[model samples]
Target: MPPSLRVSQRRLRPGSRVAIVSPSFGAPGLFPHVHDLAMQRLQSELQLIPVEYSTTRQVGATPRERAADLNAAFSDASIEAIMATIGGDDQITVLPFLDSDMIAKNPKPFFGYSDNTNLLNYLWNLGISSYHGGSTMAHVARPGGLHPLSTSSLCAALFSGGDFELYPVSEFSEDEQNWNDAAWSDPNGPPPSPLQTSAGWHWHQPDRVITGPSWGGNLEILDWNLAANRWIRNNPADYSGCVLLLETSEEMPSAAYVFRTLRNAGERGLLAQFPAVLIARPKASNIEIQPTPEQRMQYRQEQREAILKAFAYYNPDTMIVFDVDFGHTDPQWILPYGGMITVNGPQRQIIAHFG
Candidate 1:
């Protein structure tokens, strides 16, 4: 488990062919208009020819059907990269059908996050490095257009091949666009969630620099992995030097739930492995569960406090970074799974090695 193996090449030229799959939730299948526009942007904006497999747009496809598409994408010599359309809950179910040897042999770049965390972790154990962000539905097909921050971060990961700094942006989105309505494409979708005044990244126990390959994702998904006893290493030593990247999604689990999830990991002796942790800003409100501004602020504050309490009881010395805009938040940064991250506490800088 977690062996030291050479990673695949990251030097993909513009116009290189890429494959898009729906290994998780098939937003492309549900919203073909959004999917088509995203493909068009991949070609026109990124100058990449985006190809789809059989299950890419098939909403009713089974887990095996989706896994087949993933296998085909990775095995295809014509495809330089593979990306997920959106994320859903059942990616872990698709994992059993995955051909690890086939994926390890092919070793192409895979991009996604959220429930895609399942696949990312699977790839990690196989010695495959992947991009932790850049889902086609979320960033590429965003309402106003592809975000400059996302596009830039993705390009650095795709081409530059090493050592990229992920800077915090001044503005971020707290609301999501209504895909059911045509307004996202009609150029009138609430002006991209209104640019809120950003307060920047919050630091905890920032007394020393910690640099290492990154691991972990949507905390709930990791909890699912732990429960399933799949992909994760049996021994805790495998994660000894990795930085933990944890975040919650739109599901907005309560602060207590977040604490308990980590507490469970701590109980397993897994939380103490990392010298540092990066927690994304908690997405407090969803369309179904709308919270007032005050409530939203309180939700995040409580979640942050919960994490600190858990860490204090587990890995109290770990350097904790909070409210990083990487998870179920707007204008997210594309991080690398199993790639290197350098956290300089003295300079207060966080850098990612995309390659």
Candidate 2:
């Protein structure tokens, strides 16, 4: 597709009636208390109405219903934007049920990450822009108050247009405060964990500012897309001039797996096409498999090495930034997929231009 044809032009505004749909999982609606809080925050903080759909709370609903909810949100003139309730493990299932025409025509902002990467990449394939951050249940309406950085970045993504810089949050949190906890019911729970002072963004190949349309999402979820051959362009060159932002989920795939995935991308000629890659900080802990500090550091090191090796093999000149705050980590930065991104590696700065 031509560059102009692949871009969506709508920009979100305040007072937009945003639809909250569960395209993947319905955790929010299943726990109405948390979902309701998210809705409340959307209204009070953003001055946006949150419209919920049937599938938003309906666990085990067919992908058809989820697709219908997406269609409804886009088709509704009143709904200026759409946000996912949370990510799931099977968003790929919803692909067949989607109405590409509706999504292409409406072209409003859609916000999600992780499994929602399925929909984001799908929209990108349809030549529509989308956001890769902020879900109702996970980030916006956490048990404790939302992270300041997450909230700030989300607001900027929803309301602002044009070039916007993303800074490292002074403090960050990755604590998985459970939704089942009564504290979630309280709009304000115990104070969020103190953010450790930021060490600032790390840059590699810091030479010049590379600007391009943004692409990529939860790294593990994207592998599913590769398997299905669903949303990616057939030609690797189709991704040329794009800035790829990737992150791992809470599942924390083994470092070997990360390297292997990158190796596969390199083999496919995908790694060499992008001008830059912004890798989000990997989630280091999970309920089932918590790693010690040493183990976590080792994991990060291995993954980093794997990424470097793949880049060296495929695109040695590509710019890269490690540990950007997006994806499964707290203080997530909202990124606009298919929208413009500026990576000023020489200046150690990143700007996501959305409108």
Query: Whose TM-score is greatest here?
Result: 1
Give the runs in model 1 whose Cα sits over 4 Å from its true position: 187-190
What TM-score would every model get versus the actual structure? 0.97, 0.95
lDDT string, candidate 2, 207-321, tens digits:
8889888888988888888877888777888888889888998888987888888888788889888889999887777656666767876887788888888898889998899
Cα misplacement distance, residue 176 of candidate 1 (Å): 1.4
* Global lDDT scores for all candidate models: 0.86, 0.81
TM-score of 1: 0.97
Alpha-carbon RMSD, each predicted model? 1.4, 1.8
Query: Candidate 1 on 181-270: residue-level lDDT in tens?
Result: 766566323357756767789999899999888999999999999999988898998999899999898999999999999999999989
Pairs of colliding residues, candidate 2: 171-195
